[model samples]
Target: RVGEGVRGKVAVREGNGGRVLMMLATWPTEVSGDVVQSVDTLLAGVRPLPEPSVAVRATPRAPEPEPGDPR
Candidate 1:
């Protein structure tokens, strides 16, 4: 995971067999498209984390919007 001062954004998908795979990339607030591409390229080459006995996995995700959200 990227450390302090670098913020991450994520896009999540429900995988086969009910698993959840989250695509998380750390970038600056005003990040360009190239920066995002670079992060994606890096993530694609990585290995998975060690498996636990249970199926659950945890990763960063955006909080659900509150009722007062403008959208």
Candidate 2:
């Protein structure tokens, strides 16, 4: 009963601290189940990863002044 020319009902109700909207309709049996399951987890999950490791890379110490190289 929710297609073209279909008439819907509405009302105002007091919620915990505010007004809440409620919509009622007869949906396809299959669709009703999927909608009730919730969409909070519709997409994939995720988690944090440790920061990448880093090291201070210095020039190869200038070949270390060859042992007998003249000054």
Candidate 3:
């Protein structure tokens, strides 16, 4: 399940019959597209946090496939 909130977002993940994993994100005043890119970066295992001086005009990353997905 995926949900967007007033400032936060949450994605529910379930596996192995009863296990669950939840991914949540929040960004104040940032474009939804940018936030999505950040989430995709994280999910892709790219762990480098951007420097504060980096501008949003920087190239966005291509989205990665979800874990275990055939695509």
- Model 1 lDDT per residue over 1-71, tens place: 35555667666665556677777777775768788787777766555445654536556578888999975
The lDDT, on a scale of 0 to 1, for candidate 2 is: 0.40
In order, candidate lDDTs are 0.67, 0.40, 0.60
Ranking of candidates on lDDT, top first:
1, 3, 2
lDDT of 3 by residue, 1-71 (tens): 23353365566655343655666766665467777677767755523344344567578887899999887
Top model by lDDT, which number? 1
TM-score of each: 0.34, 0.22, 0.36
Clashing pairs in 2: none
Which residue pairs in model 3 clash with each other?
Answer: none
> What tens digits encode model 2's per-residue C-alpha lDDT throughout 1-71?
45664433333334433545443433344454455343222211222333344443343445567789875
Q: What number of clashing residue pairs does each candidate have, in the order they appear? A: 0, 0, 0
Between prediction 2 and prediction 3, the one with superior lDDT is 3
